[model samples]
Structures are given as structure tokens and as C-alpha cells.
Target chain A: MRGCADVRALLGDEAVYEAAAAEAFPEYNKAHLVSLELPDRSGDIIITTYGELDKNNYLDPRTAQVATVNHIKQNCTELRPAADEELPSAYIEEFRSALDVELSKYVGEAYPKGVCAVYCTSGKDIEGPGANFGFAAVISAARRSPQNFCNGSWRSIWTLEFSDESQFVEIKGKIQVGAHYFEEGNVQLDTNIDYKYSTILQSAEDCAVSVTNIIRHHESEYLSSLEESYLNLSDATFKDLRRKLPVTRTLFAWHNTLALSLTRDLAKELAIGK
Target chain B: MEAAMDLVRRMPPGSTETALNALLSLLPDHSIDLLSQVDLPLQVCMDKESLKEYILCEYNRDADSYRSPWSNKYEPPLEDGTVPSEDMRNLEIEANEVFSVYRDQYYEGGISSVYIWEDEDKGFIACFLIKKDGQGKRGYMQIGSWDAIHVIQVGPEEEGAAHYCLNSTVMLSLTTDNKQSGTFNLSGSIRRQMSMTLAVADGHLVNMGKMIEEMEGKLRNSLDQVYFGKTKEMVCTLRPPPEVLNMRLPDR
Candidate 1:
């Protein structure tokens, strides 16, 4: 291999200083760093770099220099084989049992409003370092509409894609969360709860009188936005907002009930327990 | 005119198959009641081209309010809209002319496949023809097929409701026709067929055989009252020559 000093002298400083592919191999070129014994490393740090021009084109050399210094500072001190081997059956069982042990703690919690459970299946098809640890979790909460404690049910579900990666193991995965307050056959108030359907008897006729006034406060901006298609966001966000509308109405009803209950309790307290 | 162009542009490009289907089922089911209300002595006539225009016009008029099960978007109401766009206005005129031409051609050259018989004593008499005309010629392969069927029915009187049984079978096929002349010229065709039996009594589906049995006696009684005692000469309207009449009848 030619000496760095000799090559640099041959090519002027400007050409030699080009950190990218040096304009010679513009189409394809790659570089890798294998650190045997750097300033603060007991082991080795190896990184394969492909493509020209570092993705982050921060013009400030100071920031780039700082990152380089930090990387050098964090380089591994001890040499170790990459622990990316296929996870064995025993280890998989151990991981699942551990999750079960953690979930069992919430067994006695109140869940009449709603309950969520998630399951994971692993076999020969998907088996690798990142794929070895794969599982999901779902949580559901149900709150009764405060109007009569039974006027409606507000349910929400949160699903999480969880991956276990302890130590330095490259993990690639996704986590998704969804919340739904209504299911089939449930009381479906008009998109705007103002116009009630003749087919369905209102669970609480009084509930509507109160909710109608509350929804009026929100109808102007929300309804007009719904009438037009120029919403600032994506179709998905629009659908999500539509789903949340009823949930908001139910929550408001619950809030009213809670406030009324608090006022009644306070009056009793003021009466000296009479 | 501008509004009409916008509407047209908004519609997804449709294939010839879809256009043919729309032409076939052009009449909306809800219009049947309105058609029945037309006076008994009324004589309705339509040509293929005219029928197509009438169907399209009806569709455009009702599209805004009707919530079609096949469409996802709810079309906005256009009650107060005016003919503001010159393009759309021109298109409107052109469409009218096109429809009129088609209608005229159909009236002039199209076959009169319609039949209607009315009796004041009965509630209603309705007859219509459903036909598919197809013909195409290629150098190596030629194809020609025409399928036609006519249905005639009498409705129940207002005073009395009776059960009606209808048993029918249809064979449906989805076929494609392809033609290639040289290295570059190529085309394809499509066909769909469906057949079913439907029985209705008092506006609801019922067992076909049972309803048929119940109506058989009532029909025989009516025939006896109308034609049982009539002489053959009085009842028969057409008479073939003696030679043709003397021919032997085929075995049942």
C-alpha cells in the first residue's frame, strides 16, 4: 500500500482533503475502520462505511469533529465476538416466562370496563438476532359515561410492539398503538349528537339535554372542518379524529357527573353529617 | 359547463364493459312505481340511443341525493348551482344533440321489440324486451350473437292481493374476446351471464310451487268466464291457408 504522506503530496491538499470518494470513484466506493488499539480502547471497534458524503451534511466542522472525538472515546475496550447468534429454544422460553411473571402482577386489577391481551408466536420462519425477541402488549380501559354511570361506555386500547435487546444488540422493529371507544350494536349518537335517531331510544333522555348544550360549544369549528376536505393532515388523522369525537362527548358527560357528585358530597359535609 | 366538466373529470375512467353494464341496468328500480302510474292507454316508445341518453340524464339528476351503495364519497348537494361554465354549457348542448340523434336513429332503424296489453278489469299489464346485440368481424375469426327475452305480467287489483310464483333459471358466463390482426393490432371482449328463480307473494318471497298451485284455480276460473263458451271462429283471429292447416301436428 502507498504511504498516506506520499499520496497526499502527489495530490494537492484540497484534493486529498476531500473526505468523500475524492471524485475518482464517484460511482461506487467504500471505506471501513478497524481499530486495533486506539487511545482508550481495550478491544476493537469496527464499522463498515458505504456511500460518499456522510448523510448529515452539517457544514460546521466543529460538530463533526466533536462526534468523531466522542466515537473514539466510546470505542470498545475489550475484544468480543458479535453476540448475534440464533436464540435457542431454552432462551426463548425463558424470555416468555419472564414476560408472564411481569404481567401476572396485574391479574387482580379491575378490568370489567375492558381487558386487553396480546400473544406472540415464533418458529423457524423468523429467527435471528433482532427477530429472536418479539412480543406485543395491549391495554384497554373502560370508563362509564358520568351522566348515569351506564349511559355509555368509553373504551380505549393501546397496543405496543415491544422488543427485548439487552446489551449491544442491533434491534429493528415497530410499535403501534390504537384506541377505540365504540363497538358494534352500541348506542350510536349522530356524528354530531344534536340530531337524535327515532329508531333508538336515548339511554338517558336527560343525558342528551345536557350533552347537546355541551356539544354546541364544539360544533362550529369541528363540523365546518368536517364539511370540507382541505384538512391540514392526512386521511388517517381525519379518521382518528372522527373516532375520537364520540369519546370526547362521553368523557364530557362523565366529567359533569363527577362534578355533580362532588358538589352533593360537599353539601353533606357542610351540613355537619346531618 | 365548468361544473359538468369537473364532474366528468372526477369520475374514474371506465371501460367499455362498465359502460355496457350501465346501459343495461340504466333504469332505476324506484322508477318502476312512477312508470306504473302512467295512464293505462299510454304508448311509450324508445330507441337504443334515446334510451341511453334518458338513462344518463336521470342518473345525473339523482346522483347528488342518492346514496349509492357502490360509492364511498357522499356527493354534495347542488340545489342552487347555476350554469356558469361555458365549457359545461357547451358540453350540455353537445350531449343533448348526441342523445337526440341516437334516439332518432333507434326510432327509425331499431326493432320494435316491446309489447303491452291492458285490461281495465285487471290491475296492470306490463311487457318489455331485454336484448343484447353483439356483432364483430375479424379477418380470421368472426363472431355474432343476439340474446333476447320478453316478459309479460299482470298486476293484482287494488281491492284484492294475490300470490304470484315465478320460477326461472339463468346461466351466467364471464368471457373475454381477443383479436389480433398483425403484429400490432389486438383487442379483447368480455361477457357476463346470470340466471335465478324468484317467487313473490304479497310483496315477499315465498315457496314457488305452493303459490303456483294456489293461483292455478283462480286463473282457470277467469279463463272459463272469458273464453269457455266462445265459438272457435269468434275467438280465433288469424287463419292459415287450408294446405298449411292440413299439415300433421308434431308429437308432444
Candidate 2:
């Protein structure tokens, strides 16, 4: 059985990506690298501190400022890791860059206190590192002050290991708020407050199994069709993946995107403002 | 023997009644009057209505007097209170028309096949092979007597083609015996929906009218083979080749 190629390889040539990034951001090469074990400790991710080693810039600013305040609010916490699984070492930079792009869009005036960056290195068996923009934590920290953390985004990363040749990793993040924080400048606090995420998943597993489970409803044709869209991973596109492996997408959305979105709303419900 | 040969010569060829009459005429003059009904048709027993009547007579003869009222006595009410007379009349008229039309079509080359078996005891069986236009669409239709345990089955020659069977009067089956193996027994409506879903998935369901027309053509072709083969077998069984009939006739 021919196993699938690495997900990075499937995406495109790595040299082109590195060259493009170097041309786009000169600061990208000059950044100082620091590895931190994630809070839940699934693995570690390497953080590139764009040209500086200042640790203060990465911690939530609201938490740093709240030390001066007399009244301290409860710190909003994150959901614990469901399982201690590590991501692959070779794919860490890709994961970090993807998260960086997603989180950069959320660090606007909408989140009054601004966003923070954090990194986690791969585990004992894992070689890659992952990064997250602590947008949800920023909101929680912001809630400690008299500021309303209304609109922003947060990220989540999930890694799954199949006993076979390829490893499946999904990187997704929440982008938009569902409820109106304040109506006509009056706070209309409703229990229906929710957060929704735009999801993206990258999986490198046996193409046959992935594609079959994608269309699990049509179980009858899975085996014969295993080689067609599935093993043809040499140049499989997102559209092809979406069409062929719909179940994988649903699973990725459920595990990474929906789970993260729920965690954000759960944090708000538990301790963010109240 | 001489009188029996004369009676056989006088009777019309291919008339089961005449054949039975000739056979009975072979009996001694004293014993000829013993049989109350001596002119029954040779193939009359195979007719659907005759079969039903024979079954009813046998059942009633052996039936216990205390048998439950709900037991199938093979006696259905001619006029039931639940069914209006007008509706019943309409149904009977429609049924007669359908049978007549199909019978006419079935006899006139509607089906096509070779008769492999023609035995009065074992009954008629037709062996037919149909190769559809597409490459993977070859199959065989094995049709036996209507009352046979395994009456009819349409199956792919190898695999990958659609398969269906009518095992009994009440049982209709669709089989997925391609790379995968699964079978579904569905009613008329459910089967229609399933085939429609398959057609839609294949992008041929854009025009239902055309799809239905194509289906009708396919069905007619298949039925033509099945019925035509079956009819040939039955014809051979009821009226043996003239040479064999002549060999069986008493010498002048």
C-alpha cells in the first residue's frame, strides 16, 4: 500500500513559500525564536518575536495593566486538552504561519486592549511547533478592567495520529461574534450569546479511507473509488477534498472549529464579565 | 383401438379437449361412461383460473368442518361493503384491459428468448441472456413457471450491472452485487424512488419525462425477452411437435 505524502508537500513546493515569505516580510528572517510548552501541554510551539526578545509584548495587556487596579476580576481559563496528542515536527512552521495570518485580522480597536501572541513547541515524539493569537484570553483579561471586549477572533489547533504513514492535523479558528453586545449603546445581555468560526482542515492520511469516510453515506462505492479522487493526492485541491471527503470536513469542523467556538462562549459564560 | 384412432383423426389439432377426448375413447365401452367428466383439456390445469378452482376444490374437500372462519378458503366476496360497486367495476374493467393489452403484446414478439425446457411435469423454463448497450451492462433473465418457487430473476452476467428479481408474487428484490454486496427488497413506490435517486445522481434525471420513456423502453425490451421465451416454452409443452404427436397416435 502506497502511503500518502506529507500535507506540506501536497500543498505546494516549500522553497517557493519560503522565498515568497522572505520577499514579503524582511522581519520574518530577523525574528528571534523562542519555544514555549503550551498551557495544556499537548506540545510546544516556536514563537518568532518579530526582531525583539521582549516577553511583555506577548502577554495579554489587560492582565499586565490590571495589577494597578484595586478590584481584580476572575481570570478566564481555557478548556483542558481532551487528549495529550502531539503534532508532527516538520509541519510546525506551517501551522504557526497559518495561525499568525488568521489571528492578525482580530487584533483591531474592536478588542480595546489589543491581542497577544503565544507559541508551543512539539511534544517528545512531535517535531513541529504551533502558534495561537490569545484573542479569547485577551477578552477575558480585558473583562477584568471596565472595558467591554466586544469583537475579535481566537484560534484552535487539533492533531490526530493514525497508526499508518500519514498524520492528520486540523488548524481552525473562530472569527466572528454572533450576538449584539450593546443595542443602541444599551447593554442587551442575552443568554444566546455565541461565537462562530470559519474552519480549514489539512489531513494527511490514507487517501482511500479519508475520502470514503468523507462520503460515508454512500458506503457502497467506497472501496472501488478509493484510488480515484483519494489516492490522486498528487494534486488534489480543496474543492476536490470538499466534494470527496465531506465527512472528514465535518469531523474537522466539529473537533477543531466548533469545539474552540464552544470553549470561547463557555469562557464568557463562566467568568469573562460576570 | 380403431375407434380411438378415428376419434383422434376427427378432433382438431392442438385442441387439448380433443386430445383428452381421444385418449378417453381408448377405454372399453362399459368403462367409458364411468368417468363423469371425460373431456377436460390437457393444458387446462396450467391455466391460472383453472389452477385457482382446482385448489379451492381440493381445499374444501379435505378441509375440517370446524376450520376457522378467517382461514383462507380461497372464497372472496364478489361484492364487499367496503368497496363501492362503481370502483370495483372500474377496477375489473381496467384489470381486463391491462391483461388483454399485455397478453397481446407479450404474444406478438414483445419478449425474446430461447426455450431450454419444455416438460409437462417439470413445466416450462426459458433461458435468456440480454446484453445492454453499455459495456458493463450484460445480464441474464431466468424465468420459470409463474407458480415456481424461483419464478423470475434478472441478474448481471458478471457484476457491476443492476440486478432485480421477483422471487414470489409478494417479494420484489434489488441487488447491489458489484464491488460491494448488498440486497434490498422494496415495494413498487420505494423501488421507483431508489431508481430515481440513482438516475439523479448520474445526472440523467434532468428530464423525468425522458427518463420514464427510456425506462419504459428498457422494461419493454426485457419483458419481451422474458415473455417471449416463456411463451415459446409453454407453446411447445402444450402442443408437442407434430412428429411426436403423430408417433403417439394409434396406427390406422
Candidate 3:
């Protein structure tokens, strides 16, 4: 082991003075007490020797001061994980769940490329002067959150890659929530989007609507005729909507929309008070 | 020069699909009286889709709405690392595409018809082509192995529709107002086979007897479906009722 004076004289860093002082006040060591602040983008100095600077004997009792200090300095970056994983302190998994869960709803209803990514900076119960855990933790929680789409597993997400060579509107704005603090348990995102279907959707919608309309027109007629035939039934008021027969289909199974339409129409006419 | 430049400027880049809209069979059944009056003058852009309201208005079926069935509730989030494949041909469409595939090949008469969406707007080149049937004159569409190939429009409504409690539909009807004077009549199709190969394939088939009956039966049904689909479009133009169309009008 080396003496405090000898160690200091051998390898000098002014920061070691604090280490000496803290050694004198062994019960009240400042080693684990200082505040650490992380930056918004990058460049956060996670390792600090300020406490050592103030105390002369901070690393004296343990002769491994220089080696340990060098090692800690090298490896002491903030514990920001590159991907979702179990670690000392990171909220990336939580954030991803939040974003994904919300995005799932758009599967068939809206295309994925229409969505944009944004940073969330609001959450409650954040601890400490660094505000690092508070904002970033909550942001990670939001990003990793799962978004459920109404259509369920059958429909899937689709993305349109960004390309400047094409005239498509590949670039657009995304809504982001920054460090949000929720007093209550639920995190309420109060954001709205102003979007219109791209030209692609408009064409698809038009064709879909047109085809649907044509099918509806024919099925409606078919069902009405069925109702007239039912006129002969003495007490044919059975609204058993799930009766599957050999289905002597006057129309081919090809015209599914028409069949559904006719059924839906008759349901209303029957309108059995349920 | 200006018009050509305008057309050029209007073209979307690197995309072949464009959305186009044309009126469909929105008229009521009573307008059947006007059938001959107008002489079927309306040239279809694409075979009209059987919409819910149209079915309700014309046939007895209620499709619920004209909007695509695919909504947030029906839509599921795509898996991570999803890569959208190119517009594939012969990717083998799903079972749901039975009718659409039929419409594309048999109805469109050839492979050129399409329903595509490029820039938010979707359009279908309304086309239904069926060759003359086997007897050579009935005009019944030739049913062949390729008939198994049906293209689905891939929208929300087709997958599911609570058919009028199933099997209970006796006969479908239609209704329209007066102030219209004309005779309404539809002739049978002289469906001859489009090719000799199809004719031979169909002739030697085991289900030949049932195939003919089914093909004939489906033709009528598809026509009815297309007609009713048009009716739904018409209702949208006028006023739509949730009960008439099926589901309640969307909020707003």
C-alpha cells in the first residue's frame, strides 16, 4: 500500500484533494453523493474525480487508487443501452413498447409510413437533480410501449421507404412527446394529427367503394325478393341470424359483399328488440 | 401545349396506379322501369363493388356501409423488421380473393383490368369478361381449372358480412318510384368458351354437370351483386341511414 502523501506525490491529480478530506470524514463520504447530469444528445461525463480532488486521502487506505481510477474513468460512461436489455438503469424497452403498441392500430386503417417518430419528454416520479432518470426513463417507456390495432393479427404493418428520387411524399412531420410527467397513474398522450389520405389511398378507396356499392345494389334486391317470398310464411318471424343452410345461392359465392349487405338489411327490418 | 404540360405535371412519379372514380349502380329498383329508357348508356370504368348500402337498397341484404371494412379495429400492427414486397404477380392471392380473381380474369375477359391504389386514391378499371359458354351460344362463362383463380379486392367488407341469418334468404326484390316510363328486360348471355383448351378441359371434368349449373348460377348471382353494389353508391350520394346501410354513420 502507498501513503497518501506518497501516492499524491507519485501521480498527481488536483482532484485527489477531496479524496483526502473525505477520508478524514469517513462516516460522511462524498463518493456516492454528488449529482450526475447527462446531456440531451451525447457527450455526458459520467466519471468525475471532484470528490477525490477535495480530499487528500480519498484513495489512500486502498493502494489500488491509480489503477482503479484509470479503469473507472475508462468504463464509467452512463448506462444508456443500445437495445432493449436488462441493465443497471435503462428504459429503452419500456419506451419501445409504448410506441409500438400505439402504432399497431394503424395496420390496415392507415399505412405505417404515414406515421412519424417523436421524442417523449414527460413523466412523473422522476428522481434527483440530474433529471436524467426522469425524462429519459419515461421516454424509453413510451417508445417501447405496444400499440394495439383494432384489426388484430390478421392485418399487418406496411412501410414505404423514403426515396428522394420518387415524387411520393416520403418525408413528413412526426409527432413526439417529450419528458411527460403524469400525476395520475395513466400516461395520457394529448396529441392530434392532421392528415389526409395520400393519393394512393384515395384511388384504392374509390375502387373499393365503387365495387362495394355495386355489390350492395344487387344484394339488396335479392334480399327484398326473399322477404316477399317469406310473405307466405304464417309466422316466419324467427330472427335466427346465424342459420347456415346449404345456401342455394342465387348469386355466386363470388359476390360476398352482396350477400352480407342483404343480410344486414333484413336484420334491420326484423329489428327484433334485443 | 398548356394542357399537355398540365397533364405531365399532374402525373405522379414512378407510379403506374392512379385513382379514378365513376358513378355506380346507385339507382333504386323502381328505376328498373327506366332500364330501357336510358339504354344502359353508362359505360363502366370498373365493375361496381357491391357495397352494403347498395345491397340493402336493392337486394334485401344490408352490407353495413360503403367504407372499406379495414379499420383500426380490424387492422393489426405489422411485425417488426417488416419489408413491404413489390406488387407481386402470381403470389397466389388468398381464399378471400375468389370473387375478385374471378372478376379479374373471367369478368374482365383478359388480364388487363385492375383495381390499384397509388396516391391515397384507389381506382378500378371496371371490367368483367366471360367467354361464351360450352353449348357455344348460351354465353355462359367457360369454367376451367383457371377458374379457381379469383382475385380479391382486398378490402374490409368482403371478408365478413352477417348474411341475412344465412340460408333464410328466399328471393331478393327491388323497388323504385314512378314518373318513369320504360320496359325492363335482360337477355340471357351467349357465353361461349374463350379458348378451345378451356372448352376441352371443362368438357372432360368430373364435376362437368355441377360445373355448368354452378357457373350459370354464379353468373346471375354476380350480376345481382354488381347491380346492388351500384345501388349502395347511389344511396351515399343521396342520404344514408345507419339502419338502411347497416352500421351507424361514422362519428361526424
Q: Quote each prediction's TM-score.
A: 0.17, 0.16, 0.15
lDDT of 3 by residue, A60-136 (tens): 10111211122222222222322211111223224323433343232112221122121222322322122322111
CAPRI accuracy category, model 3:
incorrect
Displacement of residue A28 (Cα, Å) in model 3 is 53
Model 2 CAPRI rating:
incorrect
lDDT by residue (B62-144, candidate 3, tens digit) is: 23221111110111222332211233211111211332333333223222121112122231111111121111112221221
The per-model DockQ list reads 0.00, 0.00, 0.01
Per-candidate Cα lDDT values, in order, are 0.25, 0.25, 0.23
Candidate 2 residue-wise lDDT at A75: 17
lDDT of 1 by residue, B1-252 (tens): 222222222122223234323323433442353332211111122333334311111122243432111121123444543221443333333323332222222212112222223336542222222222122121211222121122223344344443232321111111112221111101111111222233333221122212322232232222222221121111111121233334523421
Give the Å shift of residue B200 in candidate 2: 75
**Per-residue lDDT for B10-106 in model 2, tens only?**
2222242455553454354524342322222111111233232111111122222211111222233222222213432333323222322222232
Could you say which candidate leads in TM-score?
Answer: 1
Give the worst 10-residue stretch by lDDT in candidate 2 chain A: A65-74
The regions of model 2 sitting more than 4 angstroms off are A1-94, A109-125, A128-168, A171-187, A191-274, B1-252
